[model samples]
Target: MSSRERVLAAVAGIAAVAAAVAAPGAAATGRHQDWDETAYRGQIEVVRSDDGPSDPTVLNGTVFVDRDRDSRHDRNERGVAGVEVSNGREVVTTDRRGRYRLPVYDNMTVFVTQPAGYQVPVDEFNVAQFHYNHLPAGSPELRYGGISPTGPIPDAVNFPLVESSLTDDRRLSCIIAGDLQTYNLTEVEYARKGAIADLARRNDYQGCGSLFVGDVVGDDLSLYDEVKGLSAQTNGPARFLPGNHDLDFDATTAVHSFDTFRAQLAPAYFSYDVGEAHIIALNTVRYPCTPDLDNVDGLRPGCNDPVNRPRYNGHIDETQMEWLRRDLAKVDRDKLIVIAGHIGLLNWADEGSAIHQVDQVREVYELLHGRKAVALAGHSHSIENMRTGDAMQGWRDLFGIDSLPFPHITVGAIAGDWFSGRVTEDGYPTAIQRDGGRPGVLTLDLADSSFQERFTVTGENDRVQTQLGLNTPTYREWYVARSAWNSNPVGAAPELGDPLVVDQADLAGGTWLTTNFFIGGTGSTVTVRLNNHRPRQAVRTQPMRGEDQFVGPEWSDPAAVAEQLVHGGSVANRTMHLWRFELPTDLAPGTHQAHVTATDVHGRRFADTLTFQVVAQR
Candidate 1:
């Protein structure tokens, strides 16, 4: 090629990189879509060799500062003491010399818990590399090709760290994303335009970064790279937790269930300290669950064997449990403990499901009895902000638990009901959730131990929080007359026309102004004002006081069901976050405006308005 052609080609390449980078994030967000191959990325420097004599009994490592950012511990690089290292079982801190040793196992992951003051290294995709997966015997024959054999334990598994002021401050903004369960490449691009684009546009959350709480893919591990590529376009480092979908079904035993996950992402269960919060990401899913796994006696039969039909139970294995205990033992008593997992310890969406709720829920609560803590999870594909003292009959009947001891928030999914809905202008499905929440990401804004969580809906700004609609007798009748959605959606059903329009018979039959507060819980309140009249308080449907879940059309969100019925998705027949205000019986017939203001547990208020017509007759 001539010099002129070379210059033009270089300019075109630069423009392509610029366009891809600028398309995702806002200006100065400091995120990029593509990364230079040879540029030095901050990552845990693993200086190991296979040709040397190895010690399979124990592993040793040094946590040192990589001054040159070459992911290497040269002579000039000094040791950083007090860094905690774990072998997935025991937690030990480095000595003054920054050297520590631990007993090794065949299927253990050795990772350095990123300390608050220093930043760890990252890969090209900006995935923090803090752990080393040690699978000496590799894995059993599985479809995803679980962790390859590491041959032998290396001489040293040193971890590299670079000093940064990112986590040095007390105020922390951590993004908790959920269930990027992309089944195929098409769905993958859908995720890119949805929450991923939302994350890329923000520059905050550098302290704790983004913690994806499970269901990274929909049973296909090959999509791991695609999902990782999505993270590359984001601002902060990306961390992942394993869900039921992120498992190797071919693994007969639970030991190697997440070997491929460990090989691809970080450890299945790990902990990190960012600013004032100590984040503990737990592996709460037990694949091929056994009745023996449940201490609460909640799991059913036919879950013992995987070859026949593999079932998963929400229970943490003894290994991870012990590791959690050891890891938490190192944290300070007053610091905020953010316990994150795939299956929630207990949630409103799956309150009654023995297989969906954690068996050792009480055990986990007991462990953090006197600590300032909160829990975040995903997998139910619903948004639930369950606070302390919030009670559910299902939690009582299944786990014998009366009420929540701490705040347990179920962060909703990116793949809203498996991406089931009509295509949007953004080139993705509307993908409304089973609980009537739009696809979004959860952000925990913290100052010291105090925190206030806010959910940002996809393809919209943070101000969009509540969904207002009218639930009339007409909607109930239509809901009952709707097709058998379980099978192929076959059957003609008439739309409710205008959901806000209620006839005199409907008002007499009890019409209600429903507000589906996506993140509302026990302490939340929804107030409604009809035609700017006196505001009336809305009552929560579930009550969340150990009451059994109310299902069918009465407790449903008509607006969500309207979309779910026509677009093909999980029907929103039941949810704990719904609030209803009854309409006056002697209401004047005409169009009227209803003003809605929803106040969350933190006393944060969101206001919206809806215009509905009241006809004399249908």
Candidate 2:
């Protein structure tokens, strides 16, 4: 077993007692099965005012350290000083007495930034309760139960925090999961068996916790309760960021678009501190976006028009931008800023599209000018570990970004390809991503300010990182035919006959060993060696050097496409992780084994092998 595995095994004893403690309100849901006892019951204490709407301008709160596992601020309890509090726009730190006062608005979420060395109380569903939503007039008629009428301004919204050694430790394992877009209860079950179960099995992530970067459910927001049941099973506190799909479609304006998401999951955007990492989770998807605020003209020109209809755009509003500026000011310069959002700042899959990329890309780059930071995002189902200086044309045209200022990683989705494709024996779908990556969760193993990233494929260990296949002229032809058939349901699906057997014509034309190295990017390298021969450096398919997307059948990953096209899901047409090593047109026509090794920018290496047969003639 690995050293990390050993540490995780040893953690069970220390955590067993905590796991035995049942959450106070878990029975209310009647759904917390595997981790009912482990569920956290504590929640935010919203104290109402006797003055009603007379004194609704200002709000006051105390962040108290909750001992005895109760969600109340007793007279004997002490207050946690230096914790930052925000009314969404303005940020303020707690005074020496741990008391804070902020100007209030009717429709705003008042939350506390979870400071290091302490933990905010979580609900029965393991959702951290650090915020109080105050909406005086309720929501403007919505489907999925938007916030209930929060009558008047509260006298105090005391935030209850508990002392936790798990969050205080310098050794942190932060799990970044993307797009658990469960449209129905069945899809929710798939997520439970897949990534949720994977998290429950691991005990090492208690400190930094798990942050799901949006699309908690599909369009139907009613499934939030079912998804939260899955969240209760996780070993760490669950945090979520809203995505485009998580928006309230009935809402007419951008401000109220995520009302239901905020009520169900968390604040639209928030920040938390764990060890030396200052994690900023931003809500980048703006629903009912206007043409002007989209920044890039013509990109989303159909905002308020009857013809095109207003849709969600990749943007950060003025209010959020202001909050981010203030939030970064409080963070220490030495701390690693983990910037996470739904739609990424820039990505390889959507490198040319404005809708998939963020509009405030340049300003965000300026915000973290010299600070040590890494951007994490979802939206794009593909896994990308982009390094600094990696450039793409879509980013240049839409946002005028020449190269990445820091490492911007697009964490692969939990519900891979919308949970499409055939069901595997393990009770999950074979949802291969668009860039040919399998469904998985990302982990950042942090020691102080520095970190190393690792991707864990669903139902597989860390060692199983890359997928191996052979791309030949014959396979390319089949890919083209099958792709055309997928566009329109006509004729029988084309078959890729004997992908391992490359005939004389294939060897003469071209045949190459392909490695779909998930999370591999610029600075990363892949090499191939056949039967004791010297390793040949395989060329990366996409250079990520300011160019349009390199797509087609030749660039497609045959291994991933085989499952996607035949069953269901997006075709693995273009990818940044694919590396090709052309085979030599030599004489030997027999069974051959090719060894493949992928080395990331951090120098961590993963190995995979593929065996194929070479025939004399077709």
Candidate 3:
């Protein structure tokens, strides 16, 4: 069957399953559940104590070449020396015999950082199996079954690797997808048709593959298998990180919270090397939230709740910091370091919200020190390409981060707006993100230590970059009316006042052209030309000069608000990357075509056109 047919089949299958299953009420804020809580409660005995293994247990492992493509390490296959291994906290290098030992504790994950010029074994779902969970007593009783109790630490936990030309090549393409937050089987089908199908047809990124930054599922950890099945459709190996929503909130301690996630996916944090970059996937989310005492109210969502209740915040523990330092120490400073995390280090969407930005932003910045680096994260559904030196008042006041030390990007989510919106012709929701970006994935093309990043809208080609529209009084008035209608069930959405026809009065009253550059940021520019007129620079709505965010119709993306407000999704109230141009009042009443060109920070340009008519009066 063709790709479209396959997607439709998957959607139909999921709909059938949804019909057979029952739905549950929404859980905590930002969490959606499909299974009844009482059904799985107390099913598995909670192992709350740390009595399974003594602290600092000796854990040994070997990295060897697999000659036959099998995982087993035979005598014929020799060991590869100098490969790195970690037990979440400590980092070590294999000796000449390819043997490495690290102090492991209960609930620790022992993983190998697949060295350059070699690759690790991948499971049936194409997920890299370079790590082993060492939770001797297993996880606390979780709604979804977590890691089973492993009675004892193994004598040797070997890692098998194969040599491939993909890793050795100087040029590489990597896919980064943020928040595939499928809340239910229906949303799962939405993902299957959207980004998953798009990834299935792509042949690129077979080397570095795809790294899902976080929020693999909404709150239903049970959907991991379905998520993995989607990964199987991709053309390359898949790796994942745990987001706040992926946690088992019932767990008493932070160590056991992500047990289910680890059992199903990869470890919360790990590193791997391919081509010229060292990809460090960091677990920046801290559960049962702990923040600086002074900023606890600002960072923790339920800081005022009962102390026992679970909350989450963005933080990188001291142990992970030490491991990061050791990991970076072994790498060449010139090599590119790609840091992936669930919560962003810094972002424009949550400029004033301390909880969304990493608490240890300065520490991470200092850890990278002299290395070339770029950070990718996805908790906020908006797409932001923050360049170095980008500044805002909140980051400076709360995190003491005066300016971005390096590039930090928030990749748009595959399940944008929590997978809410009207279904499209392709059997998926439009799911326009809050920033007005359509659901998509970001691909980073790397050569040596440098890289250029671009976003691909699901089921669309690379050229579909910017969305254009006219921002007039009529549009703004309709925006408010439509938004109110969406919020209240009583009113009908009046047609968005004519976009193609602009009255002379509206032009004289300061109507302007708007361009929503989804992935645009500092160092990016938008230029517009009207009916063969000279190209004029369009001014960005928000100036990233340590100022507060600008909101409302004047700052919103008209093209995005048009659909978002009518359908069910977040209104496009504000954005950091939208640009606007004033219309010419002297133009005669006639048909006009406006050509818009958006140039990204890396000098890559994308063009889009908008045609509208100038009328004498409405």
Assess the local accuracy of residue 478 in candidate 3 as a C-alpha lDDT between 0 and 100.
Answer: 80
Backbone atom clashes (below 3 Å) for every candidate: 6, 0, 0
- All models, RMSD in angstroms: 4.4, 6.6, 8.5
Candidate 2 local distance difference test against the native: 0.84
Sorted on lDDT, best first, the list reads 2, 1, 3
lDDT of each: 0.83, 0.84, 0.81
Q: Tens digit of lDDT per residue, candidate 1, span 473-517?
A: 888988776745335456655666777788899999999889999
Clashing pairs in 3: none
Query: TM-score of predicted model 2?
Result: 0.92
As a whole number from 0 to 100, the lDDT of residue 271 in candidate 1 is 87
377-455 per-residue lDDT for model 2 (tens digits): 9999999989899888888887888889889889999999999999999799999999999998998888899888888
lDDT of 3 by residue, 30-64 (tens): 22122112011111111223443243378766788
Score every model by TM-score: 0.93, 0.92, 0.90
- lDDT-best of 2 and 3: 2
TM-score of 1: 0.93
- Stretches of candidate 1 off by over 4 Å are 1-40, 49-55, 294-298, 484-491
Stretches off by above 4 angstroms in model 2 are 1-40, 52-55, 304-308, 488-491
